[model samples]
Target: MDIDAWLWWLIGAAVLGIALVITAMPELGMLAVGAVAAASVSGIFGGGAVLQVVVFAVVSTALIAVVRPVAKRQRTQRPQHATGIDALKGRQAVVLERVDGSGGRIKLAGEVWSARALDPGHAFEVGQEVDVVEIEGATAIVM
Candidate 1:
């Protein structure tokens, strides 16, 4: 028995989809979508082989060229949620001890942390609220 051109295109789309799942490469999925478009051209429109090939190539290349950059940009953008020490920065902390530039202590995020004032001349008295500016090697710099 002979398979129709559209059936072959669908098979190709299926193989590409399987490869996408195995390799975790999104480009393969894009190619699979292109193959499905080629199948539509062949089965629905009765297009010639050259037209089907052109549709597949154009669709695949367009997806890679247009979608890949956007995906990469989105992936590379800075995350919204901070974790660990990063989450502590920019938060308010209460001075547990007199905090000067050299050293002190503060209640940060329900835990005591070694802290210092951001400015050498500035100091925070005990029971005062301060803003956590940054974390440096087990120390929180406050302002």
Candidate 2:
């Protein structure tokens, strides 16, 4: 039995799509789209093998050139807002108990948290407000 060029192109597109999903690579998806275009060229226009390959190469290259830079830029940009423990840092917390180098308790973000002073010599009294420097596991390092 003879297989048409379009059928082969479609098979190649399916393989490329599977590879894209397995590897999480956007480029493979682009190539798969190119393969689809090549299949269209062969099936709809009855184009020759050379023309189908040209269409595939042009589509793939164009997609990579145009989309890759935009994707890279977006990935490199930082989020506008912080979440989780990161948001807790730089926030003010009220000392519930005497907080010193060793340890103490504080009311942070409406919740009670184990806290300690940044400096061993520095201490915070009960009801006093302090800044959260960082979070170490379940404990908050304050100043």
Candidate 3:
């Protein structure tokens, strides 16, 4: 068979293998597939050493540009619910345990989290409704 045909087959196989491996191990699969595709395409169509280098560079650049944004978007989407303590401000919560002026625990979205009072002398008892007023570092300030 022609070298071109063999190269195409290799590329196809690499892509298919990537798809399979992605289901079980996505990181390794992505790297293997990208390398295979770049090598196969460059080996087939590149006319000389310089052309091969250029083709590989272009393909690698394109892959980085395309894959990076997609990966970033996926990561952003998964963690979009709430992030830094600032995100908790103004949200309502219930005291999970008694809170003195210092610190205590509260329940937010069915999850118990560390909390502190925003105002001095404020005390919250277990099961009492509280509103998130501010965030100080990793702690939520409740009223």
Candidate 4:
């Protein structure tokens, strides 16, 4: 039985399209587009198998080369604002315990928190206002 080259390219395009839908990767979508281009070249343009493959390779590679870096750059960029515990930094807290560098507790952001002094040997007395310098796990580093 003889199978047409265009039929194979059509099948490849369909398989790649299905994979793109399932994976939700733009790269897979781009490859499926390349397969479709190859199918069109072979079926409509009556291109040889080698020419179809060259079109597929060039289109797929160009898409990856141009798009992947922009995607990577978007992923690597930092968010504009701090969130969660990061937002607690530099906020004021009321000392709930005699806070020393080793360990203590405080009322931070209206919640009770484990706290410690920013400087060793420095301490915060109860009822005194202190600033949260940073959060280390469950503990707040304060000054």
TM-scores, all candidates, are 0.88, 0.73, 0.40, 0.61
Question: For each candidate, what is the lDDT?
Answer: 0.97, 0.97, 0.70, 0.90
Give all candidate RMSDs, comma-separated. Answer: 1.7, 3.1, 7.4, 4.2
CA-RMSD of model 2: 3.1
Q: Where in model 2 is the C-alpha error above 4 Å?
A: 1-3, 21-26, 66-84
Residues 44-118, model 1: lDDT tens digits: 999999999999999999999999999999999988899998999899999999999899999999999999999
Model 3 spans with C-alpha error above 4 angstroms: 1-84
TM-score of 4: 0.61
Question: Candidate 4: worst 10 consecutive residues by lDDT?
Answer: 28-37
- Number of residue pairs clashing in candidate 4, backbone atoms closer than 3 angstroms, sequence gap of 3 or more or interchain: 0
Candidate with the larger TM-score of 1 and 3: 1
Say which prediction, candidate 2 or candidate 3, comes out ahead on lDDT.
2
- List clashing residue pairs in candidate 1: none
lDDT for 32 in candidate 3 is 47
lDDT of 4 by residue, 1-143 (tens): 99978889888888988988888888987888788888889989999989999999998899889999999999999887888998899899999889998998899988999999999789999999999998999999999
Q: Scored by Cα lDDT, where does model 4 land?
A: 0.90
lDDT for model 2, please.
Answer: 0.97
Q: In candidate 2, what are the lDDT values of residues 1-143, reduced to their tens digit?
A: 99999999999999999999999999999999999999999999999999999999999999999999999999999888999999999999999999999999999999999999999899999999999999999899999
The list of candidate 1 runs beyond 4 A from truth reads none
Choose the strongest candidate by TM-score.
1
